[model samples]
Target: MKIVTKRDRVSLRRRVDQGTEEQRAIVQSILDDVKANGDKAVLAYTEKFDAVQLEDYKVTKEEMEDAFASVDGEFVEILEEAAANIRSFHQKQSSQSWFDTSEDGTVLGQKITPLEAAGVYVPGGTAAYPSSVFMNVIPAQVAGVERVVMVTPPGKDGKVPDGVLLAAHILGVADVYKVGGAQAIAALAYGTETVPAVDKITGPGNVFVALAKREVFGDVDIDMIAGPSEIAVLADDTAKAHEVAADLLSQAEHDARSSSVLVTTSQALAENVQTEVEDQLKSLPREDIARRSVEDYGMIIVCDTWEEAIETVNEIAPEHLEVITADPIQELGKIKHAGAIFLGPYSSEPVGDYFAGPNHVLPTNGTARFSSPLNVDDFVKKSSVISYSAQALQKNVDKIARFARLEGLEAHARAVETRKERWK
Candidate 1:
């Protein structure tokens, strides 16, 4: 990681968007094919990309049972514990339908209802993250979604990883499918023969998968167009150099473009961290990916004071922000933009990523400035409920008509007038 001053913060903040025009075109073609051809197209793409041919796309109950049985009992217990923590944290976010009434007999309310079905995408290939499965599916389930359909790419032998399947089984998600990539997203957007259409799609994926989510957005609701992983460590002289280095490398190993930055008040600490990151990188199993990410995108900005460092963090709006200052709690209010904030040295990024109660499905590419982490709210919809009695209409119809006329919406004005006459 390169050490620099606060002056370079602006130039270093901009990250290249991963999906290109070519990727968008390819994802669009896949989406169109799935929309037109349905199951046949999904199967063809699954075979072509995943190198697997599947006669049955959906995982059967027997297969799920087998997956559960295959997992070690100890790991299954750990997953259950993690699921409980996640469920407990999100249950607090649940919303209830509420109504209000006025003296003139006007009733207004918001009816909160969970979507009937939701689709969750889990990437396949080298790694299988049961934590991600728990993070995405549990929130939807807690929101009262009737069905949570999960789609993942199958291996060359046409099988989903046992760990992924076990996590689904633990969550009671029975409608898991053996398909992935842009094709799976398309299937969810427009219902295939076997896969049912969903109310929304939520999960992380590669560039093609991200582009596919972008293409099918209107057809189905998506959580967000996920970018590469990123983390920012806002530390002072009091923070440990080794601990800070480890936290930065955690996100760095995620992807080549994944950014790991440090904004500190002490130049001495910054120099120490820069050397520590390189020393730790030599032993990492994913050294090549982490090295590329740290060398290209990683940075250390030495600020004059803590205020400047905090300001820089808000400007960048990283997905994960760790504040390891003297009193981390004092800096909490100053952190205006971050998908998730980890405080103190013990609160590392992985805690939230796996065992912690928070959802790991967060906004990226500086979207934390506006967007939020995936929660129960993402799986539900709200409708404004309104009702007016004759007394209410008599009191307000003329004012409503006048406002409608101002907008040149004659039909709207007449609608109010007609109601007012009836009230009279």
Candidate 2:
């Protein structure tokens, strides 16, 4: 970690990775093949990329039972508790159909409808993330979606990870598929012979998956195109050096492009955390990845005041923000941008990632400025309802026609005019 005393030297923005033309071309070919050939293309790509041939891609009930049996009792208990917390949190975000009736016999409101089906893509190329199963599937279930499908690549042995299966089983999501990469995304976007197409897709994946989602966005809705992970800690003199260093490293180990930054008013705290990060990096299991991340993107920015520190954090718009100041609560309202905020020393970043109720699928790469975390709302659609009474139409018809004609939309003006005479 590099420590800087000058405020002008701090920069945390990372370049978003939009895959190369070659990669884009490859993803497009796979999407087209899956769109045209459906199941056959998916199977061929699975054999080529995942190195496995499967006559059937769906995970059977027998396989689910085997996976459930493989997981220990204690881990199952933890997954249940996490699922309960996630369900409770997302249930609050669910909305109902609402209509506001006016005295003039006009009705207007919004109708909330859950999608018929939703797909969750879990990554299994490098490591299996059981937590992602809980984060993605639980929200869709809470939104009252009729069907929730999960897709994950099979291992070289042609079996999904036991932990991923256990998590889906606990959530009661039985439609699990043993496929991944852009091919799985295409299968989800366009219905295959076996895999069902979904109204929306959510979850994080590699560059190929991201590009696939981008290409099929118009035909079906998708969560934001996520980038690498990021964490920004705002601390003060009262904050402990070791705890802050540990929190920063939690995100640094996620990927080589991951960024961990600290902005503080205490010069001593900044210098201490810098040394502590270097010391702790020696012991991390993912030391090589974490070391490269910290070496290239990590920073310890020393600001002259708390205001400067807070402003710097807002500018970065990190995916995760930890406030470990003397008064974390007082600084909460000042934070205008962050996908998720973890306050105090005890609320480490990992708590939100796994056990805590908040959704871990958050916006990254400064997108927190405009986007938001995955929630029950992502699985549902909103339709605006309008019911115009005869009295209301008669009152506003001329105004509407004049406004439409002003825009040079003669047909729109006539459409309103024709309705006015019928109502009159």
Candidate 3:
């Protein structure tokens, strides 16, 4: 790992900060095609890219049943537990429609209404993340969203992941389709002959999927356009170097683009973690990805004090932050920017990503400065409602009429003025 001295490193975000425009153009074209041709375009892309032939895009009841049988009972039980935890946490975030009445007989307030439908895109071409199924669907269910439609790429034998199916079942998501990539996003944003259009789309995939979500955001509300995974650990001599190294590798294994950084006050701790990372990488399943990430993006900064480490952390605004220090809570108070903050040694990034109640779909690539993790708010919308009795309208009509006329909206002004005439 490269060592960055406080004097050497630039303010950090001096790094390459935006997606390639070429990628944006390619994804935009895919989204446009899907919007125009619907399911026909989606199926063609799936066959061309994923190499899966599909007679029908929709997964049958029989396929779901078969997927359930293929999975172990123990894994299914774990899914149930994770789903329960997710639902319990999101239930607290749920809001209800409310109204306020005045003495003048006016009733006005904002109403919180869940989207009629939500589309969840599960990327199946590269890897399966059953944990993501819990993250995307559970919040929607908690927000009282109706008709959750899910799409995933199929295997060579035309079978979806068993864990994905079981997770969908646990989250009360009945609709499943075999579609993937940007085309899948288009189908959800715009109605297809086979798949119904959704009011919102949520979940993570590759660059193509992220680009697709960005393209479809206005047409159908989307959770976020996620980038690469990242984890920043702020540690002191109190933290176990081995555990810190292992946690860093865990996130680095996500992809070569993924970043894992350690900011510590101890030069000895930094050196120990560097050695531990090499030793631990020998046994990891995705050692090549982790190794490449560590070589290129990973860094260990030996700072003068905890305050210097925190200053560096705030500048980075990493997607995941693990604060392993003498007092985790006290250190955490200094952190103002991070998608999610892991309190201590036991609360790793994967803990929140899988079993923990919080949503794992976090802001990545330094976006935590302004963005947030996916939540119940992503699935529900608020609308300001206004109503007034005769007396209330009579008193407010002149003001309303004047405001509209000031904006050169004659019809709007007339509408309010007419109400005043009726009130009289």
Can you write out model 3's per-residue Cα lDDT over 120-201, one digit (the tens) per residue?
9887855787888888888888888878999988888777888888787666677888888888888888978988999999
Q: lDDT of each structure?
A: 0.91, 0.92, 0.85
lDDT at position 153, candidate 3: 80
C-alpha lDDT of candidate 3 relative to the true structure: 0.85
Question: Which residue segments of model 3 deviate by more than 4 Å?
Answer: 11-25, 396-424
Over 119-212, each residue of candidate 1 has an lDDT whose tens digit, in order, gives: 9999987799888899999999999999999999998888889999999998999899999999999998899999999989999988788888
- Give lDDT for model 1: 0.91
Ranking by TM-score: 1, 2, 3
Model 2 residue runs over 4 Å out of place are 420-424
TM-score of 1: 0.98
